[model samples]
Target chain A: MKLREQLTALLTSLAGVWIMSYAWIVLKLGSIHVPDAGFLPFLCGAALAVLGVAWLLALHWTKRKEAPAEKRLWHRPLSSLLLMIAYGWAMETLGYISSTLVFVIAWQQIVEKEKWAKTLSIAVLSTLAMYALFVHLLKVPIPSEFFLR
Target chain B: MDIFSGLLDGFAIALTATNLLFCLLGAIIGTAIGVLPGLGPAATIALLLPITYVIGTPVTAIIMMAGIFYGAMYGGSTTSILLNLPGEAASVVTCIDGYQMAKKGRAGAALGIAAIGSFVAGTLAVVGLTMFAPPLAEFALDFGPPEYFALTTLGLLLAVTLSGGSIIKGLIILLFGLILAMVGLDPISGKIRFTFGSIGLQGGFDFVTLAMGVFGLGEILYNLESTMKTEIVTTKLGKVFPTLGDWADSRWAICRGSVIGFFVGIIPGGGAVISSLASYAIEKKYSQHPEEFGQGAIQGVAGPESANNAASSSSFIPLLTLGIPGNAAIAMIFAALMIQGITPGPFLVAEHPDVFWGVIASMYVGNVMLLVLNLPLVGLWVQMLRVPYGILAPVIVLFTTIGVYSTQNQVFDIYAMLFFAAVGYLMRKLDFDPAPLPLAFVLGPLVERSLRQSLLLSGGDPAIFVSRPISGILMVIFVLLIVGQTIFFLRRKWKRRCCVPVPPETEKSL
Candidate 1:
């Protein structure tokens, strides 16, 4: 836990430095009187850096304490996230209907381990429901299949 | 316009078939989400934000969103009473006595009082809003750029302090949000800042997409971590109406909660959670039988429920009058207003009276809708809890994806949503509250624009912030908050080092 906190603090400071540097070198932090676009960003970056560094120093000075490890039920969430990325990519390529049907089925079967019949019905229903709602009712321009286009 | 006249005109607008239908829809959806334990009002609103595009008119869109906002307050107590599981953070206090009431076979009474109290408080707070917002906006018309800057900055700072975490962590997140807000074309110069040459980044992050990503998808992912399912208490609801004795005990509690909630909700960082907790404390202190607080006390069920609902209504005061969001949910509405091209501020009352008053009047109708929905139709809401999260999670993901995609028809936006979803999940795991991030992000542009304008007006004089009366007072408060927090932090640290006793083994080693 302590290590994670320190690392997070370190990353934050590093990010601050990068943003500050970018604003200074590229955007040109002009005088406050004639402030440029980078002016507020620069100030925010500086403050973030200070806070991050102060946190780091404070963490360093304090005695390290250990916390109980959170039981790693992370696999399910992680797998779903990866599947979602795939779903997004597939939606663009294969189009909304096919991709959604497949994604829902995959999540219910793989992550949730549900029965096949119920999963298939839900997948089909939800996909068609969204399609009707977004494309037809609301007139949202969902991506279509390459062949259809 | 005179208050009565404005309200009459507002009723005319709100009573239209279109607005009334959507208001009912919003109420039903709001109550459903409120009954469900995991999905919150903020996430639900964020998920539905894209509907504003096709929802015909901003007035109706805002009316529905507002319904969802206060309707959640009415519905949250149902789960607290029946299940001992708070549907949202604000109802956590209700679980103590409300669940007890259920065990005593008074679930119907607890539920009844909660609904009635919420309705009363919601109506009272709406009255307060009707009276106060116009005058406040009229006064705010005198505010200059410096004052706006100070007010927004103070709002952001208050959010940071009241966000409930390490002050440093909250500040870091706040700055991070401000930086993210800078990632588009400069308002004044039209020069892009941090797009990195991507065409997609030029227009900056869509408020709807980012919100859907951070609050909607992120929350679903976090809830995905806990695989354990919650069991609903199956105690029979005898009669969904409070007795006269119960009402007599709670009448004062309801009134006191409404007043406390309304006042607290006006503060920048105060909202349903704090107000409900405060109401509970006050009710306990003043109750004739304080010992019965956590033992099925009707006052316990009534007070916090009323306060949370009242707070939900009154929190809109800041957003409507000052163009500042009081909390995360209000921030989403603030974004909705901006998306509709309606700049919410002092001029909102004068310039867009239809929207200003239409939403206010819709609350009256919506509160009644909530009361009807919550009392006799509560069993339907309980049925919602039975739907397994395994099924609900995927549907939420689909909605979030479709919602984000429908906003701009960009695959890139979907990717951005995914990215923020991951970031939000990480933030949750690390104990960093993501609430301030969106609030800061929403306020960031306003802050920067106001700050630059103020400097330009003063010819780069930083003293302009201190010279003006309103801005000066706000700045003083801002500085004191920082200094006070710093002092408190240091004193705690010093005490930890000096006063904490060491074990003999550690002392010998030293």
Candidate 2:
């Protein structure tokens, strides 16, 4: 029977294997007196590999499989992941207020889709608070252009 | 007279206008983040670690940040009780009975009991912190690297107790976290660990990044996967106060929890979860109606809430005394202390009395601030529950990235955050936990430094670890912890195979 685990599970398993492989390569760098750095990562990688094996084994033992895979894409929380990446990319260029304003607006209306006035009110106030807290008060520099930046 | 004089000195520092205002701000910010779903106390402290650098006076910064810590403890139950989302580790127990209470339309009473219990616990905890802290520091002063390594091993072993559904899975995640902790440059040799030849890895994974990914972003991913499990849809119905008997019934539970939690929190590896679970079990074990535990007993909420708050406060004793943080938030506090060129240890009390007692005094003020912050703002926080994951999720990521970037002015942190986000998402998929990662990242350098120092001190003798009395005791505890958890793991696997419910692992994963 086909397994129902999501893209996340597949990625996790792949990562486990890859990290373990990297650990092996690092471990092989020397014979005796391998640095503590090498020792830790090798251990970490082995842990990952063990995890991968255990996860697969548990799935096999459980008898019941995960939910169907076809439905995974439809439920990927795509809006969230994409919007987040965009926010990160845009923040430095736009500054804190501008990017935050745009992100908040897109998030509220597009993702949350609340009424216009409420969305606008929350978006403006939150960005302003973040600005005052980080940039003005704490003196942490934030990108300041995009919104009504 | 001595106690009163000391408290008076503490109040003199805490009562200053500057400290008071900072304390209020810290409580407000801490409570805000704690109430926000997915941003646990560890991540919040980790995120704020960079900012604490900007504030003048290590004493003032520590005082204020300490406010944020227990403020979050006070804030956590609001969400768990109202939303059925265990917003913080300690609040997991709250969700069991507190959420059920909310579902049954007793959220007001549950919240009321939580606040009152937390306040009682906080007040009592300050007494414990004051009494035990100095003496503890005196004892810890004699300790050395061997003791430290043993303590770290014991701590890592206890991670098994924090396991949910699978002990092996918990240890696996912890090991991964330990390995990730190795990424930065080697402390002893100055050689890079797991940088994979990248500059980013040279510095190693910051607690902020690991915490941001594993606890904060990872939580967002988990919520996305199982939004259906949350009880927010049941009804946002709630009032703002508790009945008289509700308070009466919980008063004893709160007192018991405060005492238990204070003692437990003082122990190096024991923390809020232990207190919470222990308090809940005690309440269940001795209650007139033990059967009502999973069905939203008010005592469950009161005892656990008190225990969590007390634990959060008393943990400072260890961090300030032994230079060992009992939890991740304290670890960040340690980093903040280091940034100020201050190392917390036995002499810290005598040398940096202001930072020491200032933080101790601030807890009293912070607890009061938390109570004030929690009450009238209860409505606001519950409103936060309705903010919907879709809107809040992106903001969490955005704040995380910007926060990380703004610290170093390094654009690479954004990528690191993303990589961890992906790794975090995957860990959840494979049923791996992230709780141990921050602990590992925080303790990694300390362990690395200690191991090398021990080896150097003993002319490369590994036996040095077992040579000390303190170290030997820690080793024994470590062994017992591993053995106990192995049995637990086997029992759990047997249960899973048998299709028995495991109480949803609420309190320990607490």
Candidate 3:
């Protein structure tokens, strides 16, 4: 855990350096007397780098305390995030109803492990309900190219 | 108008048909959200932000959001008492004794006291808001750019210190938020800094997209990691009304909680979590039988429940009066106000009296609605616990997706939401609190604007921040806080270095 945290701090510090260069070189961090667009961004980047480095140093100086390891479930969240990404992609191509219906069915099965009957009924019902709420009531201009017009 | 007339005018607006309906809707959704763990009031408000566009009237939209904010406090204890699960962060303390009471077959009594205590404290806090907000706003009218800059800086610093993580990590996130806020066209120069030429990036990140992604979708994805098995209390609810003895045991506790919560909530970094924790500590200390606490003491439920509700109510003061959002939920409301073309600040009360008073008055009405919903209809809320997460999770995702998309009718926003969702998940896993990020995002523009304006006013001397009396004091405090935290961290590190056993080989090398 300590090593992971230290790595995160290191990455944050590197990101700060990148942002700083982008601001100072690209955005042109003008003189403080006549501040420009990149002035605040430059300060923010500097602060971030300083803080990130400080955190890394603090963690380095401190002794690591080993924690009792427990089995952590990551597959559900990982798969769910992937499904959401796919749903976003499919929403544009497959349209709201078709994409949402497929996504819901997949999520209920893959993440939830529900029975086919329950999953199918829930997926269809939820997709329809969401369609009604967004497209019908609120008149959100969600893509409807494929179906559920 | 004075407080009396202002309140009366507010009541007039709140009683209108549309506002009443939205208020009730907010209360219902808030209760449902509170009864369900994982989805907090902040995420719920973020999820529903786009729908406010349909509502049209900012006052009515705000009434609903405010209803959700306080109503969640009222409904949060139900799950705590019945299932030993906190419905929200504020109700975590309630689980310590509330579930014990349920085990003792006093679930009904616990639920009853929580409702009544929430009602009493929420109302009292609203009264405090009514009395305090106007004067605060009036005082804030005297502030200039330097003072505003100092105030925002203090708020960000306070959020970092109180956010319960490594101060350096919180500060890094805070700076990152500030950087994100600078991604679009420069307000002064009109020169884009970091859009990378994407048209969607031109407008920068929408507050709703970032909020929904970070809080709404992020929370859902994180919760998917572990499935909670709820062992709900099955004891038959006797009467939903508490006995007279319950009131006697908790009357002083309720009063203390109300006062504590109100004052704490007014601070920039204070909110329901700290208020409830403080109330619990105080109740345990002052109780005649401190051992009774965590062993089915009625005061345990009443005090913290009251404090969290009161804190929710009072947390609005800074937002409504000074345009500073104290927490993530209030920041969402602030975003709602901005979306509706209303800039919250000292001018809000004078310019949009209906929104100012209507929202406050509606809190009183919402509290009553929550009490009615929580006490008599608690069984209905408890049933919500049984709803399968499988259904709830997908539905939440859909709503968040459509909600983000509807804001600008853009697919880019949905993608942005997904990106932030991933970031939020990683941040949580790394033990970095994401709460301060949104708060910083919301305040970034204000801070930058105030800073630039103050520099211009002082010819870029940089002493302008510390030259003014108010801003000077605030800057002093900010420096002190930073120094204090550094000292604390170094001392701890030193202690750890000396105490830990060193290996013989390593010691010889040292």
Best by DockQ: 3
TM-score of model 2 (CA atoms): 0.83
Put down candidate 3 lDDT per residue, B130-238, tens digits, no spaces: 9999999999999999999999999888877875666777788888788888888888878887888898998889999899989988888888886447788899866
Model 3 residue runs over 4 Å out of place are A64-66, A147-149, B491-510
Q: What DockQ would candidate 1 receive versus the native complex? A: 0.52
List pairs with backbone clashes in candidate 3. Answer: none
Q: For each candidate, report what fraction of the true interface contacts it reproduces.
A: 0.55, 0.20, 0.60
Clashes of each: 0, 8, 0
Which residues of candidate 2, in runs, are more than 4 Å off? A1-79, A91-129, A143-149, B1-7, B96-107, B163-165, B224-244, B267-269, B291-296, B375-377, B386-391, B487-510
Model 1, span B67-111: residue lDDT tens? 988888888888899889999878999999999999999999999
Cα-based lDDT for every prediction? 0.88, 0.73, 0.88
lDDT of 2 by residue, B435-475 (tens): 66666666766775676567667776777877788998888
Worst 10 residues of 3 chain A by lDDT: A62-71
Chain A TM-scores, one per candidate?
0.87, 0.68, 0.91
At residue A55, candidate 3 shows an lDDT of 75
DockQ of each: 0.52, 0.25, 0.53
